[model samples]
Target chain A: MDDLSTVWLILAAAAATYLTRIGGYALITRMRTMPPRLEQALNAVPAAVLTTLWAPAFFNSGWDVRLALIVAALVSLRYPGLIMLAAGWAAAMAARHLFGL
Target chain B: MNRRDIIDGLKGGAVIALSTTPFAVLFGAVAVDNGLSIVEAGLMSATIYAGASQLVGIELFGQQVAPWLIVLSIFAVNFRHVLYSAAIARHIRGYSFWQKAVAFFFLIDPQFAESIRRAETGKPVSFAWYMAFGLIIYVSWLLFSVLGAWFGSMLGDPKVWAIDVLLPIYFLGLVIGFRRKPGFYPVVAASMVGSMAGFHLVGSPWHVSIGAICGVAVAALLPLPQKPDQSAEVTH
Candidate 1:
């Protein structure tokens, strides 16, 4: 694509993305309060979304990644966020080098 | 706006930034390596911001895919953000139109998660807090992407440093963070199983959205044991 077209493509993509971000809010605002079932569903969303994001990566990865995930999960019991992440990263690096993955 | 809110927002933003920075850097380096100019790569990151979609866009561009198709595919990949926006709409209801417009630009996954958590805690939702969280991640992401594009070759393979593991690990930590909440295990199980099936069957990033929808459906259908006091208080 030409330079101008490329710029237009990026601009169009940005517009589309902004629509997704704002569209849902606009729709929900029109409804005022959500129904109970919808509320339950929304409440479950974070866990569901996070799981969907992580599970494929966990299952598809090699032993090093799997081991790293296990380490992260175990560490998450005590240290929920950055600390767990740090430990997991360290463990993954260790597993990769040690096992030559 | 308050000191406490700023501190809280920063703390939340920093945690997410820690996980996301590597992904942004990797995207920058890879985009440059794949024939995009530094300016193009920067513009893509600044505009798209969503990591998975941006990566897909760069890959398709490298393959000489039509620009329209590239943009459409990225839109599909990021459609999940619509659901996120819907889920968090209640919290931001008080904000004016312009504030909401600007805030939605930074409505990435981490910001959504933090805002939802705050809302659930029954505290008044602070737009300032959410903006602070989003701004930190946004600025750092743009900065790191440029840095990566400029010096990415020196970093070698991102996988060599185990950068690939960061996201899944960080997300795993988030799933665990919900351990104390009611209905956690069942919700997580439904989501994971659904997502795995979607990954193997549906392909692409559709699995994440598919799994999320299935999880929400399943969780909503399950009968909850009575907690009259808690159940009486409605949550949005």
Candidate 2:
């Protein structure tokens, strides 16, 4: 794509994303109450999204990312802090380098 | 707001803001890897402020796909932010226009969660302090994204030294914290399984949306004991 096209594309994507953000707040501000169902649904959104997002990273190439995710999961379960984050990252990186994942 | 309230808000905002940096760093690296100019990536982080959208945009961009399709994908990926904004709207309704605008920009998942948490605890906070929380997070994201882009340029690839572990660690920690009720487990289980299934079956982005919706639906539908309200409170 040409420069103009790319820029336009980026602009369009940005606009669409921005509208989504704005619309939610605007609607809520107008409505004065969040529906129970939406609240219930929102509660699960991040976990589902985050998990799906991580799957490819975990399984990408072979199973190194998956193993790393498992290690991270364990570390997070126990520590649940920055150190755990480092542990998960370290384990993943080590495995990736060692196994060429 | 009083000084104490402002201070508390700042504290709340700072803690939440701190969490956004790592996410920005990842987005920064991804943006570069996807062939975006540093300026473009920085703007996306600074202005858009939605991580999932930015990430999806980069992925689509990397594929050299059409811009409209990328935009649509990002829209789909970030649809959840609407729910977030809706949840916070009541609290910010009385703020000045500028304050509302600024908070609108910074209101992402963590800040929204923190604000709702505060509201539920009966500590109704001012929009100004909430803006403080939002701004601190927004600025941190911008700085970290810039840094990440620069760092990514220098480092060649981001898939090094286990950095990929950040996502799971951060998310799982959040899940543990959020799932305080006994009834939350089924929802958590559903969501986790749903996400895995979405990835193997559906595909990117959609997997997230579908999985999350399914998990929450299952959780909401499942019968569970309801505790009597301890604190008399309202969300807005």
Candidate 3:
């Protein structure tokens, strides 16, 4: 595609993405209040979305990645911050080097 | 816009920014590697400001996928933002139309997480704080993206340094932060299974939405043992 076409495509994608970000607020603001069940569901969203984002990659990758994720998960449970993330990365790199993955 | 609010907002943003910086750099390098111009990569990061979707877009662009398909795929990948908007709307109800517009444009996952956590804890959700969070992330992301594009080759392979694993690990930490909440495990389980299934059955990006929906469904059906106290922190 031409430069102009690529720019337009990026613009279109950005527009669509912006719409998703704003659309829910626009819709929800008109409603008086959210239902309790819906609220519960909404509350659960972060965990669910994060898991969904991570799980497929976790399961489909090689054992090197799996070991890395396992270390990350265990560290995250205890540390739950940037420190945990560093630990996970360190573990993955260590595994890759040691096992020649 | 008070001094304390500014300090707090910047503090919050700085914490997230530290975590996100490596990924943002990686994104720029990867985008260039995938044949995008530095300007194009920078523009996408500025406009889309979504790491996952932007990565997907670059991959699709490399494959010469149709423009509309790329847009549609990004929309699907980012559909979770709709839920984020809904969750945050209640807190920002008093903001004017334009203010809300600007806020929504910057509503990436980290900002959403931080903002929602604050609101649930009964902290005042000011426009300034929200904007600070967004602006800091936006500026840093753009800066790193450009740096990555220009010096990406010199940085060498991200995987060699294990930078590729950081995102999943960061996300895992975020998920773990919420583990104490009621019905959390079930929701997480549903999402994991649903996304894995979606990956095999449906394909790239759709799994995210599918998994989120599955999680929401399970959480909605399950009975809460106790009403969640808004002021209570989910123990880290």
Candidate 4:
């Protein structure tokens, strides 16, 4: 609530966040050789981690959000990043403003 | 150190920075609305630098959640960065200690994803390119957060512009970009199902790690790639 404590809390949270950011690298660096299964798991990290960002939103949100993500995924299949983003944004804006979803 | 790498990194990061602008602004606005002063909101964005966790931290802060609990929540929300840095260790291990330290600090979702992509594609993950990318996103993040805080109350509902959909869609794009990787389908499916279940049963932050662990477990269980010849008796 107070300024000092709020600052302290932010800094503490920052430290904890940094710990997560580096914790994996620190652990891996300590190892001389990595196991195959562990390498597989690490290779899987991108899809695994990034999926959580959207899957819950897709299953939980309204039609507008779902439509936007679907549109984005479709665009991504054929186009580049900026184009995919634009198409998704357009889809969402149209869904909400034009169709009132 | 190549000029081309700098240009490439800047161009790529600038696109992501633009995509992330809405969320930064949204976080800034929400932070202020939740009783954080403008400076406090900016500080959170500057220091934690993880968008989703900063949001969760601020939401709990607004609710007057315990300080330690808030820190723990940020840690939980950001736990995936551990996996990211671990996954990327081989690619950037050649960097100096200080470079790694600074690189790890800027290891946001996009940064990690892009770095992994670069490495897998055989491009050198030069520090020049890496920081060019990271710093662009970082600076824009800090700037827009403060801007959003400054204009917090003045802005209307985000839903009208559909600003809420951008982040999820952006992340969806990133997820789709990894479709060619081995075990992508099963892993994504497991994470999706696991996350949806966790979202219903558990809640935010926990769902991320829970789903991630589920997906990673599926990845571990899925058939290992058969490398040619004596791949050194699989040892854990």
Using TM-score, give the best candidate's number. Answer: 4
Backbone N/Cα/C clashes per model: 0, 5, 0, 0
lDDT of each: 0.81, 0.67, 0.85, 0.89
DockQ each: 0.62, 0.44, 0.59, 0.65
C-alpha root-mean-square deviation, each candidate: 2.5, 3.7, 3.7, 2.2
Between which residue pairs do clashes occur in model 4?
Answer: none
User: What's the lDDT for residue B177 in model 1?
Assistant: 76
Look at candidate 3 and give me any clashing residue pairs. none
TM-scores for all candidates: the values are: 0.91, 0.81, 0.94, 0.96
Docking level of model 3: medium
Deviation (Å) of B25 in candidate 3 = 1.5
For model 3 chain B, give the 10-residue run with minimal summed lDDT. Answer: B227-236
lDDT, candidate 2, at A90 = 72
Q: Supply the TM-score for candidate 4.
A: 0.96
> Which is the winner by DockQ between candidate 1 and candidate 3?
1
Of models 1 and 3, which has the larger lDDT?
A: 3
Candidate rank order under DockQ: 4, 1, 3, 2
Per-residue alpha-carbon lDDT of model 3 for A1-101, expressed as tens digits? 77889899999999999999998877776766566777788889899998987787689887777888888888776664877887888888988898877
Please list all clashing residue pairs in model 2, or write none if there are none: A58-A65, A58-A66, A89-B162, A93-B162, B13-B133
- Please tell me the TM-score of chain A for candidate 1: 0.88
lDDT of 2 by residue, B82-197 (tens): 76666566666567777766666666767776776777688865876676667777888888888888777565555664555566556665655565644467776676677667
Residue B34 lDDT (model 4): 92
